[model samples]
Target: MSPRILILGGGYVGMYTALRLQRKLRRGEARVTVIDADSYMTYQPFLPEAAAGNLEPRHVVVPLRRVLNRCTLLSGWATAIDVAGRTVDFSPHRGESRKIEYDVLIVAPGSVSRTLPIPGLAECGIGFKTVEEAIHLRNHVLAQLELAASTTDQAVRREALTFVFVGAGFAGVEALAELEDMAHDALRYYPELKADELRWYLIEATDRILPEVGPEMGRWTLEQLRARGIDVRLGTKLESAKDGRIVLDDGTEFDAATLVWTAGVKPHPIVRHSDLPIDAKGRVKATSRLTVEGVDGVFAAGDCAAVPDLTNPGEYTAPNAQHAVRQTKVLADNVLAHLRGGKMGDYRHAYAGSVASLGLHKGVAQIYGRRLRGPLAWFVHRTYHLSRVPTVNRKVRVLIDWTLALFFRREIVALGALSEPRREFELATRDK
Candidate 1:
């Protein structure tokens, strides 16, 4: 019988692994099955653009059913994995649960937003991780603008136009910058509104922003944001957010209609279901070869696996797309070696530089020990990520979207009505 390879999560790790295996593995050599909460995988790098309405949301995602033709796609969650019993229990949204025995398992469920227990955070804050969240943010922002424009109350208008983003990481910065640019461009439509009336604040607990680009670049990013009139509060944390009112640790308080949280991420909670060896951070422990340490016929990588960094020695690889994409090749190769009774290969690569977009036609990048900024870095950022946006079909679609963007104005038309379209229908037929 052929080996059964079971993979969890359809994020970058799971999707890339399945992509490689389907091409390399021969017919019936191994039966590959992937189970994920969602049937499609989102290319998260374009999420900010999607939120700003610079790119269509659908173009930024890859549909698994259309791409993974050779593998069994299960749309559900992995409730538990009895590693010793060699069976994985799967639960669907609207169906009975079942256990599927597997020869090998790959736990790559990825990460979730690392949030704090600060008051009102759960009720007020929205994360900038997935496509749904991105679109919702866009709608919410536009709704705030509409509210501010239509209202006569100065206090209410001020609160509606105020935007606060906690955590100065890549997601927070990019999303804030992109949306700010969009909102600034949108002010012309509102005759009563002035661009200066919209307030943008980037609050970070640490002293610097864009930690991936190093301190100097982080300072440069700070200067750029400040030049654009953003109120950047460094070394400040969110103390409370009770009732959608934000209170900062440094004795600042305000009511903001939108609160975006993009601080960090913790490994997927699904790892606890299995007896997989985990570290203190709740990440599955794995060796440099992408093999789950001390676990036979099982492997892990990407955000969920704490794969040791051979280049850095003492530390594990950072949870980034660069590492995850490169690790997939090594994982796929090692899996082939395991099937053929050969030794597995080690996964090692030095950290490549990082690039960040600071609004349209503005960016900062550190590449090969060299720093780049402005339009050149922004073009490079778009080009590099566009090259890595999955299949050629998606590549073409995204490229087309970009090309059209140059000739057309951004669509600030928010479809808030889409959320509750049934409201109108229900009211219309209530008497009947």
Candidate 2:
């Protein structure tokens, strides 16, 4: 009988691993099944562009059903993993929970936003992790602009137009920059609004932003943002956000309708369900070969696995797409070797630096010790991610979107009603 291979999460690791196995596995060599809550895998790097109206939201996500045709696709969440029993508890989108047993398990559920217990944060703050959040943010920002334009109350207008982003990582910096540019361009439509009236703030707890690009490039990026009139508060932290009232640890307080949190991430909470060996940081322990440490016939990678860094030694690979995407190649190969009684290879790739987009035609990058900025870096950023976006279908669609953007103006239409499509219908049905 062929062994059953069950994969959790359809993000970078799970999807790519299943895709590789589908192509290499002999007929009926193994039964591969992928489980994820969402039916599509979001290309997260393009999320900023999607939010800023540079790319359509649909083009940024790859439909799992269309790509993984040979693998069994289950739309659900893994409630628990009984490692010893070799079974996982799963709850589908519209069904009761059940147990799924597999001969080999691949845990790659990925990570979730790392949030804090700051007051009012849960009620007022938004995250930038998924495509849904990206679109919602775009609409919300534009809606805020509309509100400010119509309001005569100065306090209300100030609060509505103020935007605060905490944590200066790639997500925070890129999202803020893109949306700021879009909003600035949109001011021409609102005769009552001025560009300087829209306030943007980037607050980071640490002393630096984009630490991946090294200290030198980080400083340059900081200066560039400041030159564009963005108030960057480094070495600071968010104290409270109760009711849109932002309180910083450095004795600053303000009200903002939009507060974006991109601080960091933690491994998916599902890891606790299994008895797998984990690191101090709650990530599944993994060796250089991508297999779960001390576990037989099981593997893990991506943001959830703490795979030791061989090149740097004494450190684990940083949880990012560059590493996650590359790790899948070695992971798929090693999985097949383990299943077919062949030799397993180790996963090793030196840090390739990082690239970031600071709105259209502006970017910063450090690759192979070579630093670039401005249009050249921006072009390189788009080119590199386009090459890695997976599937020619998505690549072509995204490229077409970029081409059209050059000849067209950005769409600032706020579809806030999409969030509550049935509200108007329900109201109409009620007696007046």
Candidate 3:
């Protein structure tokens, strides 16, 4: 009988591994099955643009069934992994629990939003992860302007116009810049809303933002943000956010309806529940080749696994898309080698710098030991990401969006009803 291979969480690692195995391994060698909560793999780097109406939300995600045709695709969430019994317990899209036995397992369940205990955050704030959140934020930001313009109440207008973004990382910085640009362009249509009326504040507990791009580039980014009238509050923390009142640790207080939390991410909670060896940071501990330590016939990778960074001594790789994509190639190769009884190579790659977009026609980038800023950097950022955006079909669509954006104004329509799909249903039911 052929050994059954079960790969969990169809993110970068899971999908790539399955695809490679399907191509490398023979039909009777191993039967590969991949399971994920969602059938689509979100290309997260494009999320800020997607949120800013620069790109379509559907284009940012790749359908798993279309890509992984050779492997068996299961739409569900893995609840538990019984390594001892070689069985995984999972819950389907809308069904009861089911268990599947596997001779080999790959646990690559990715990270989730690492929320803090800040007051009212759970109820008020929205995170900048996934396609749903990006679409919701895009609609919400546009709708805020509409609400402010239609209302005559001063307090309501002030509350609706103010926007707060927490965290100074790539997500926070890109999201704030893109949304700010969108809102500014949208205000030309609203006579009552002025650029000054919209308060854009970015709070970061750290002293500097964009640490990935080095200090010089980070400093330049700070200046660009400030020049745009954005309040870049460094070394400040969000102490509380209750009833739309935001309190900073530095004793600043403000009332804002939209609070976006792009603060870091933690390993998915499902990893903790599994009987796998985990690191101090709650990540699955894997060898340099991406195989789970002390677990036979099991491997892991991506944001959820602490794969050793062979290039950097005494440190595991940082969780980022750049590293994830590069690591996935090695992970796939190593998994196939292990199955074929060939020698597996260790994963190692040097840091290749970072790039970040600050709204339209502006960006900061550090690549191959060179620093670039302004329009050149923005162009480089777009060019680099466009080339690396996975499939050729998505690349063409994104390039077309960019081409069209050059000739026309951004789409400012806000479909806020998307967040509450059941609102119309509830209204219709009540009317009946």
How should the candidates be ordered by TM-score, best one leading? 2, 1, 3
Separately for all candidates shown, the number of backbone clashes (residues 3 or more apart, or on different chains) is 0, 0, 0
How do the residues 154-227 of candidate 1 rate in per-residue lDDT, one tens digit apiece? 99999999999999989999999999998988888898899889999999999899999988888999999999
Model 1: residues >4 Å from true position, as ranges? none
Worst 10 residues of 1 by lDDT: 412-421
Q: Compared with the true structure, what per-residue lDDT tens digits does model 3 show for residues 155-243? A: 99999999999999999999999999888889889988789999999999999999999999999999999999999999999999999
List pairs with backbone clashes in candidate 1: none
Could you give the C-alpha RMSD of every candidate to the true structure, in order shown?
Answer: 1.1, 0.7, 1.2
Q: RMSD in angstroms, candidate 1?
A: 1.1
Regions of model 3 farther than 4 Å from truth: none
- lDDT value for model 2: 0.94
Error of 2 at 375 (Å): 0.8
